[model samples]
Target: MQHIGIAKLGKRTKSLVKRLKAGDIAIIDHVDLDRVTAESLIDAGVEVVINASSFISGRYPNIGPLLMASEGIYLIDAVEEDVFNQIKEGDEIVVRGDKIFHKGKVLASGKTLTVPIIKEKMEEAKKNIGAELEKFATNTLYYMQKEKDLLLEGMKVPESSVNFNGRHTLIVVRGHHYKADLKILRSYIKEVRPILIGVDGGADALLQEGYKPDIIVGDMDSVSDEALNSGAELIVHAYKDGSAPGLERLKKMNLPSKLFNALGTSEDIAMILAYEKGADLIVAVGTHANLVEFLDKGRAGMASTFLVRLKIGEKLVDAKGVSKLYQSRAKISHLIILVFAAFTTTITIIMSSTTIRGILRLIILKIRLYWGF
Candidate 1:
């Protein structure tokens, strides 16, 4: 099969997806592409994907390729990295089976990842998951030993202009099911008026959901300029040494921000910040929790996540699968049944009440006399 589209290239799938338009061929260098990136690509409506690296390198059953295949998106995997240097953005490229062509010149060739191929790889990856888990656990232990101070006594929490003391603080991360989970919490957000905190690209997610985040925290790499300029207080997640790469972007944009210098992921820092500020309850949406999720994010282990959660304890409510926990709203069929029951109850009351029956009968008698029936 032959497919043609304009090429848009980026080494990072997250950054590339922002520029992707419907029917545009996405050229990415993602390896063992994670589910979230696949979802982003699909959302961009790209007709075809050309990956410079393996779609699945037997890396613990990553489902990005499987999802793309299932969605019928053409995937050309493991192409040469030089394709980035060879093809310019907006160059019309043709994918003839497993090969990419630019201007009728064969640019690069790769394997076409089909469902069967991805499934087989996934099974193999699952078989090696035990080994992956062993390595992950080892890293976790090693880091925990060194970073035990995080749990023993947290870092100096920065004072925020936005108050979290004794109020619900919603921390959003751009993880799995983040969009659906946010949609489910619309009413809670409207009612409780929680302090909304967005971690990096999560700030964009909040904006897409029509929420103006009260505070934006993260490395500031993945977030959009619009979200940064939304008047939300910004906090740059910095290294323990106080090196904040994200701060430069804020400076260039002339957006003022505070720095939270600590270890761990941005989401972890956000939670710790809220807890340190004496938040009564912290609600987390789309934050990574499981081993697979941590692995997908390329973290050697979830050591920091484990320690952060241990520190936060019960105040942290994970809303990752809350959408599956209960129906967010009553079904239309259920609403119909409720309306029918209410109508039936009113009719039954009118028929069963003697005073109501007498009144109805008198009204009917008066109408008949007036018409001389």
Candidate 2:
């Protein structure tokens, strides 16, 4: 029931956990009810939440409202700064309609305030994002072509025999909000369990969540050595001319890896490899699937991804933005209880059964005799 100003809420979003740890109630301003922001706030253990800007206030399962209710946190929406100003930090504030009560004291009384129309603001943000995506796609396309040219050259050289069966394989490309996306794709992962592959920085992303990738495929830049040494097979994306700049780095780490002289990004090569290896399903996580996502990478064309998707057809599932739609925080308490129960049951059965007792006694006697004890 504490009253805090809107300014304090703005500051808490930047480092919510730190503020909560210091015993500050948070007021979140201008939240989109996006899953990522909601989960973050919940994880930070905020006691009460106040949303200044929420597009779908009570209609949808917005992250803010869902999290607030799930974590037993109080929620108040559509309040103005005037109401905020009337309340100070640590003041017990209660909300009943538009009235705010602070420790049984009336702070302010008014009808629910309406927010300014923000469709224009949203459109502006989308427009800016689109522009950035286009630039990224262009750059990505250029690099892909360059890499493709090099891969073509390497094909001319005699290389080790590689097996290919057209398997559906997924290569992850970790970008913004990738962690959230991964959480959403957890079910798909358990179901498909595709030959999990990581491309450059994506390998680190997998490692961050304790997922040991089946293969680490990339140009060797932006990936940590720990990821490279995670016991997964390594495939270096090299130019067609058979020169892989990343090979030296792997050698420096005393690691052994295969060179994939291909003309696409590491992700592209990974898909190609998986498809060629006869994978049944390809589930992508934190990878570019839409135009904006591809453009964000500065690629001119998502030719590789497009072709791979087409080739994979119904087997391909893009997991980008999936987290925004779903939320799951797995609790292992039941699993822990099951394990403990199983162990206790086994102990009880062994101790109570005459046959088991005789077997144990014989085994102990044999052990003692063997040791001359």
Candidate 3:
């Protein structure tokens, strides 16, 4: 198949997705492409994806390549690095099979990804997944040992204007199935009215779903300016050394924010902030839970997540994928109550109406006459 489109190149897939438009060719150097990036690419409506690095490194069966393949997106894998230097943004590029062309000159070539090829690579990756798991577990234990005390002893949170005391809090992260999770929680959100917290790009997710986040926590790189300025309390996650890269952007934007210098991911800090602020129940949406999820996030270990969950204990509720397992079915008790209420309302209506009472008395008198009672 032959297709032509404008080339949009970036070393970072996440950053590139923002500028990408439909029918644009996305040139990225993403290795072992994660699901989130693939989803972003798919959402951006790119016509083709050219990667300098391997999409499936045979590491642990990353589902990103498979996801892209399934979506029928043309993927060129393991292309030469010179492709980036040779191509400029907005240059009309042509993809004919495996070769990329710019103005009739061959810029680079790579293998075109197909469903069959991706499936084969996934099979190979799965075969060696045990080794990957061992390495992952070892890294997790190693880091957990060192990081446990900091998380367990309690973390120092920055002052926040939002109050979480005795109220349910919802922390949204732009992780796997986050959209579906949020969709399922619509009723709960309306009824419980939890304080909404969006982590980085998760703020955008909230906005897209017609939600206004009460708190926006992250590096502030992924979130849009509109979200940051949506009257939400901003909290910048910083390194242990007290350096915050995201703070500069907010400062430049003239947006006031509190700095929470801590270790671990931004999602971790968001949860910690709610816990420290005495939130009654903390509900998490689109959080990374399993090994593959952590790997997808490029996290080698779940040290911080494990410790944070432990410290938070039962107060934390992971609402990830709850939509798949359970639905809002009416319970037996609820159904019974509903039926009883309906019956009571019918009887009350009949008793309250004079015409209905007269008709009932006439029917009773006729029955008594017929029976000679």
Candidate 4:
């Protein structure tokens, strides 16, 4: 089948997704693409994907390719490494099987990934998990030695302006269907009104849902300037050498922020910060917890995540989907909202039809007669 679309190219998949439009061809150089990137691209409504790197390097069972293929996305893999240079942005391009043709010229070629092919590759990656685990474990041990002081004793977290003391803290990260989880937690949010913390890009996610974050924590690379100035206290994540590059971004924005120097991911430090500040419960949404997720994020080992979870222990809850079981403890305000909703519905029904109004009156009279009123 010959497929055609306008080309939209970027070296970084996440960055490109922001500018992508529906029906455009996405061109990228992501190696062993991660699920989050795939989800973003799918959300952008692109029909075709062209990758200049190995889509699955067999390093781990990454679900990016599988996600794209299952969603009816055409994935062309291992094209020339310089394919980005060949196709200009907004060029009309056509693909037939593995060949790329533009304006009657053969520009480049690669293998078009299908669902079945992705399934087979994932199976092979599974068989190699044992070796990958060994490497991950070794890396963890190595980093733990170098960063133990920071993880255990040297963690200098500042007093957050947002008081999390004895309160429930919700940390939102833009990972793995976070928007779905957040949508499900809306009611819980309204009732409990937990202290909301957005990790980098997750801050933008919170803004999209019409909630202001109490605290924003991360490396400051992906978060927007508007989010930085959203009145949320910012906590900057720093490197092992006590240098925080994210501080520059904050300074340019002319906003005040505090720095927390640590070795692991920003999300890990965020959890630690909440736990240290006496949060009674920590609910994490869109944060990666499994080995596959770590590998997908290019983490050699999840040492900090491991240590932080052990520290938080009984107070932490990971929500697979928050919409089902999470309900806010109902209060008088909830009753008021419910009653208001019922009143609005009653008024609409009464105005819409005369017969419906008569039925309601008859039911009320019957109740009054039965009560001898």
Candidate 5:
């Protein structure tokens, strides 16, 4: 069958998989069969696949050809661009080796379609191994819960701490989708410009993006010294009694911070702090907004987030997937200005250099001699 040429599979494969619907044959440009990403794609039920990458280009064991063969899927390698040029979006074509046997004729020859078959096999594997996965997930959840309890106990201390007044604040949580969400929010840094706060690892994420978080609030396990020293106010999340274990880490780093003895996630405390600080607008990015994401992180209930968001009410905006909703487009004027600046800089550099002038003159003389210019 004719497949759409949506090749160039790399780090963006996951996003593309989420966007694609079933029965759409994706012509993947490259394949790394041994990677977990390959398995994820296979599980996503991509109907047809083409591997435009070299199977044994290096010492790395190529798994694409083997994966296709084991799954009884057609595959081809070292084919030319002519094969892809012939295929359209909705053409019925039989895939076999490099040659596409279509209607008793060789329509196009190219790499094997491995993604669709791998997806089918991955589904079969998941069904057979579903129970084990569930059990593992359950155990992980239990462990996380116990850890959260321990952390909560350590957070309780009878000390002077920061108080929260009902204001709008966003507390970012570290999770699987955190990076993706953070990238989305980075673009809106100037627009939303909320009191940026990070919870532990989330603070590290902010630091990674060169953003000095306004406040760092969390248990302080995963946050780095660099992040703590990033000029943001630090608030250690503690229990209702105001005991905080994270304080020790800060002490070790010779950093001073206020302890906020409270219940719920560090993000919840951050929101409370924002509200208390009279923040009118609270926009949360890379923060958990859905039950699945929360549960995945072993949170039993998002009571704190619920209450905090409730308090913020009208002023709170959850920008979880805002990056996907809009893309920054370069304006014509901006592009023109950039191009003009680039040309001017190039001319200036060329005019300022004797060696470059000689090289250009030699090239121009060669061109003239060749074309009689």
Candidate 6:
């Protein structure tokens, strides 16, 4: 690209997304960019991404750069560690083949990511992925051996005010395409009124959609203070020995919460909790469902998730990216019916109104008198 506009800077892509407008250049200090971050940048309508860290370190095929490049965004890879420090926010900048400039001076240089390069890197990543998968298997076996109770007998959770018995429970995680998925299930959420459970940052996601979470489950690191106090019942997911760091934060905020010691990720616990509460169905949005996604979340072992599926696969449904399934609008037939109803209501109003009928007759009589008919 010949020229670019103001630079929006943030170390975390998620934090930066709220400020990004269409065509804004994003400068982030992220390494091995995950697909979710790339999707967020794309959704924010950013045209250029300047990374202060490696986009792909050949570490298990991090799909961020590939997704960005494919989406027609210019991605400059790893200019320098000091790129973030050197570039000030709101500075108008120019890009020329991996070089970033301001005031006719080159600020930093790096490699411009291309489709071919991404394919090559992905090939290299495939080789690395094998070893990573092996290690993940080992970790899963180790954790499964230690935490067999979570799957075998089920987890004994603390008493909760929100009941999930015989109800459909929706668990949201601030993961890939969470916003879109939640939007797609809007009708289901409204009609069924599923028990809403927000996992960490997912609580913020629910709040963004104007829905209050019935329960908030997670480590409580990324959720906002407002969400924590939105009257959602809080459950702190602690380690097996019952040490909860997030619990301390809740206490400091004077918020009441229960403790749940589990082995899997918070999202996993959310599912398990709904399952044990006798939920008829569990609909998950933005939760990791595949190996690539689990890797995207930087988790080595999915033992807890594996066991969770084994325990409740019949009742569980993953609705990741469900927004792509349909258009975000009423159907043409539906719109036509709505228009017809409005037209029929107007006609009925006109027919029933004496003033309007008299006005219409008078106007017609006047027209006839004027025409001499």
Candidate 1 C-alpha error for residue 231, in Å: 0.7
RMSD of each: 3.5, 12.8, 6.3, 7.3, 16.9, 4.2
lDDT tens readout by residue for model 4, 293-364: 888888899888888887789999987556556655789999999999999998997889989888989999
| Candidate 1 lDDT tens digits, 1-373 | 9999999999978889999999999999988899999999999999999999998888699988889889999998889799898899989989999988888899899999889988998998999899999999999999887777779975897778887879999999999999989999999999999999999999999999999999999999899999999999999998988799999999999999999888789999999989999999999999999988888999997778899999989999999988888775778999999999999999999999999999999999999999999
Q: Tell me the TM-score of each prediction against the true structure.
A: 0.91, 0.47, 0.87, 0.83, 0.47, 0.78
- Residue lDDT tens for model 5, 193-233: 55668888678777777777777888886676788888778
Give the least accurate 10-residue stretch of model 1, judged by summed lDDT: 145-154
lDDT of each candidate versus the true structure: 0.91, 0.61, 0.92, 0.89, 0.59, 0.88
Off by over 4 Å in 5: 1-171, 191-193, 329-373
Q: Report the Cα lDDT for residue 79, model 6.
A: 83
Model 6 regions lying over 4 Å from their true place: 2-12, 15-26, 43-47, 59-61, 70-72, 82-97, 100-107, 123-135, 241-245, 248-252, 324-373
How would you encode candidate 2's per-residue C-alpha lDDT over 1-373 as one tens digit per residue?
A: 3433222345235344334532344555543454434555666665556655542333222233444455665556555556557665555556555456666776655333222223333344554655655665676567656545333332321232333345445567765467878766666567756566888878877887768877888888767778888988888888868899999999999998888876656776776666556667676777666654443343456656655565557766777677777665566998898899999999999998999999999999999999999
Please state the error at residue 90 of candidate 1 in Å: 1.2
Poorest 10 consecutive residues of model 3 by lDDT?
146-155
Positional deviation of residue 83's Cα in model 4 after best superposition, in angstroms: 0.9
Ranking by TM-score: 1, 3, 4, 6, 2, 5
Error of 5 at 24 (Å): 37
The alpha-carbon deviation from the true structure for residue 113 of candidate 4, after best TM-score superposition, in angstroms, is: 0.6
> Model 6, range 227-309, lDDT digits (tens) per residue?
99999999999998879989989999999999998888999899989988889999999998777777778787788888888
What's the lDDT for candidate 1?
0.91
